[model samples]
Target: MARFNGTMVALHSPRMNGRGKLMFSRAVLLCLFLVLSSLPVADADAEQQSSEKALREHYDLQEGKRLYGEYCRFCHGEQGKGHAFNVTPPPADLTSPAVQRKSDIELAQTIHEGERGTAMGSWKWALSKEEKQYVLLYIRWLAQSR
Candidate 1:
């Protein structure tokens, strides 16, 4: 029997054993399995969110903006839409999906080693590794803001 909202309801199972106990243990086990299986997925999502938050805290967006202004703005423009200069093939639009889809390491490498056949020169000699990361963070912010 089960009580719900001040009402008692009889719980019956036609497939009960001789002891008068419901033979629905498999159903209970299945429900338990489903619930337990979902726990790891929830934990993974929470972990991902926390890691992203940590990354955000680790980087300074203000410094990134400053670096962008000093080094990247001449080509990428104030909004990072690119094509600010009249160069052939033009600079990559930092806010575009194609650029945004690139991994941080790839973008960082590009910043460290300038692309061939383009006006984008290497910043390896100019900015430190940390500064390059800051610039990457600013690029991500640009994509989001757009």
Candidate 2:
């Protein structure tokens, strides 16, 4: 936003009479108020963004836990390790160094497309990107809490 340059405005104006001076002071006050009022808007926007990010993360953690229970527990087990059910292979231990070493993108991709020739099935048809991330974050939190 363009700032009000009072000096430039004043220079362009004719010499002020007592009444004009009063009007000029009022205009300057208005300009200052406008500038100052706008300053807090920037702060408010940043604060709002921070709050939204935190809220989303909180929701992801909660939803991820829920989703893990509903979809993953049958195989991955409650602790993200192998479950008792017999499949050709078992679910990956999410906390294992090998799995944890995968990049976030790689993890996301695996979640999206599942492991080929394994019990893991592609969730791409069922989960959104954000949903996948939530599960990923929950998986991370699992490792972290462990």
Using TM-score as the measure, which candidate wins? 2
Q: Write the per-residue lDDT of candidate 1 for residues 1-146, one digit (tens) a residue.
A: 88989899666666667565534666677899999999999999999999998877555898899999999999999999986888987999999999999999999999999999999999999999999999999999999987
> Candidate 2 overall Cα lDDT vs. reference?
0.85
- The per-candidate count of clashes, in order, stands at 0, 0
> CA lDDT, every prediction?
0.91, 0.85
Clashing pairs in 2: none
Model 2 Cα lDDT, one tens digit per residue, 53-125: 9998898899999988877778888888766457877778888989999999999999899899898889998
List ranges where model 2 is wrong by over 4 Å: 1-53
> Which residues of candidate 1, in runs, are more than 4 Å off?
1-59
